[model samples]
Target: MRVPILRQGPYLIASIQAAVTDEDLLHLGQEVVERVGQYRSRGVILDVTVLDVMDSFAARTLRDLARAVRLRGAETVIVGIQPEVAFSMVRLGLSLEGVGTALDLEDGLALLDQHVRRRGKGGR
Candidate 1:
């Protein structure tokens, strides 16, 4: 599907749309991780505002991807989650506990910048 991953300074940004299948997400995970390492990104912000229905598989994939990215020494942030989608995810019992979220892309990028700076200062 070639989800465009833009390199913005030390961060990677992606805007996901349309219906994402399991295979597509898997490839995306791999590609993202590779890019993270290749670019040595400090953080990533993925905009999921256009996703109307986030199924369990997709939610799980996102959570797992975030964790994987962290293991690669990069922070992950999810932005633009609609209220109904958030409620639906909760209702479906898929608690995105460890996943970082923001009200919008700007907030996500700002939050990620802060996280990266804090981590850099903390050296952890």
Candidate 2:
């Protein structure tokens, strides 16, 4: 299934609504990167609120996606990682290094705003 991505001013918000396969993640990464360039987006907010399981592959995919977005001169913030999911990732050593994370969508947006400001980039 396709992940819905919404462009909010200088930010792109992608909310993962359910458990997704590796292929879905790959597609998501590619689509997010393309959209970042296409929209000249300054930031990306990935909301995985409904995601209950976070395996190593999923963690790695998300880390790579954030890196790719960074290369496009955009910042990526992953939000809504449930407490259980976070615990599992930590236990499994699945880290999303070099990527910012927040408690929720609102927090993610705020974090992105801070990043954009720090980089001297304009925001919405």
Candidate 3:
């Protein structure tokens, strides 16, 4: 299924409402990147609360998406990773190394805001 991306202020939020295939994840990455550039968004929040399983490709795609968004002058935060999924990911040694993660949508937005504020203060 195609993920829907919404623009909110300076951020783009993509909420994955169901399980996704590799193609769907790839499409999501492409769409998010394009939307970030199109909207000149300052950050992106990917809500994956509904996903029960995340494979290596999914993890890599998300990690890459975060990196790509960062290069476009935006930050990316992944939220809503269920506890079981997180544990599995850890057990599998899958890591979203440079990506920011939060407990939920609200926390994700706060994290993005924090980054922006820190950058502003540091003149970065």
Candidate 4:
């Protein structure tokens, strides 16, 4: 899997390219957390638009990724979820309430910027 690292102000955007399997999701989560720490970023916006489908493993990995980001003193946001996948997640009872989500990459970036500014002001 090739992960593209994009530096946009205080946020480090990671564009994941390739399917994230269950076995590799953990490592990917760790990588994202490490990258945030390395960059000292306020947040990470994951662009998973390339993924056509999201399975239970992927959803669980996302949850774990959010936790990892928090542990590293950064926030995680998921972007570009397809309608079908979103419906499936909702039907499956997967709650993404605690994690950040946006309809598109641009929206995600904006949200991250807002979050970073808020955190900076609050010293969080």
Candidate 5:
């Protein structure tokens, strides 16, 4: 089941709690986009802790979700990618460049909080 980890002020945190199939990945992307719209949030922290594998579809979906968040005047940060998965992404030349990433959930929230503070300082 998809679980939202936190909701603080204008920031929301969500978890992708399973090995996502291609179809599920697409649905997840859509759901994130929709949630961003529904919440009118400023940022999102996506906890991918339960995801052990990252395929092309998952990567693409995440990229799409980031784009969608931006279009909704929000930002997306991905977290909890295992070291091995990070290595694989680097080896595959996957570009999560514009998308923020954190080693763990706490770091992800801290990053998001920082971004929010920065944006509040007229960085938007």
Candidate 6:
């Protein structure tokens, strides 16, 4: 149940797969946030393309995770949401508020850089 979090300068990337329990997801979120502080990361990119179905609880967990990261002074971007999943989540009123998202991992990384630049932090 160890989630792999990779550091890249001032950023972290977490690619989550399926078959995860709610507890595991919570643990993963905690680890990601902790690593942000440990690494002093300015940005986080969570690749959720591998997730096919996300329950409301899981969605909430993600939202909480993003907020937690932001509270730690880092921007978080959720990337790789499938078209259908995106539609379903929106339809279910699970749209992640106050959270950033991108089409894919590459786009998410670019978005993070943009956020940093917009905040007057030069690109790394």
Off by over 4 Å in 1: none
Which whole-number lDDT from 0 to 100 does residue 124 have in model 1? 76
Where is model 3 more than 4 Å wrong at Cα?
A: none
At residue 55, candidate 4 shows an lDDT of 77
Residues forming the 10-long window of minimal summed lDDT in candidate 4: 16-25
lDDT of 4 by residue, 17-68 (tens): 6665666666777777887878888888888787877777788888888987
lDDT: which candidate is best? 3
1-108 per-residue lDDT for model 1 (tens digits)? 767889999999988877667888888888888999999898988889999878999888888889999999898999998999999998999877787999998999
Estimate TM-scores for all models.
0.95, 0.95, 0.96, 0.87, 0.86, 0.93
lDDT scores for all predictions?
0.88, 0.93, 0.94, 0.81, 0.79, 0.89
Mind giving the per-residue lDDT tens digits that candidate 5 earns over 83-105? 88888988887777689999887
lDDT of 3 by residue, 1-124 (tens): 8888998999999998676778988999999998898988999999999999987999999999999999999999999999999999999999999999999999999999999999889897
Q: Where in model 2 is the C-alpha error above 4 Å? A: 121-124
Ranking by lDDT: 3, 2, 6, 1, 4, 5
At residue 45, candidate 1 shows an lDDT of 87
How high is the lDDT of residue 124 in model 3? 72
The regions of model 6 sitting more than 4 angstroms off are: 121-124
| Candidate 3: 10-residue stretch with minimal lDDT | 16-25
Pairs that clash in candidate 1: none
Worst 10 residues of 6 by lDDT: 115-124
Poorly placed runs, candidate 4 (over 4 Å):
none
Better of 4 and 5 by lDDT: 4
RMSD of each: 1.0, 2.4, 0.9, 1.7, 2.0, 2.3
Please estimate how well model 5 matches the true structure, expressed as its whole-model Cα lDDT: 0.79
**Against the correct fold, how does model 3 do in TM-score?**
0.96
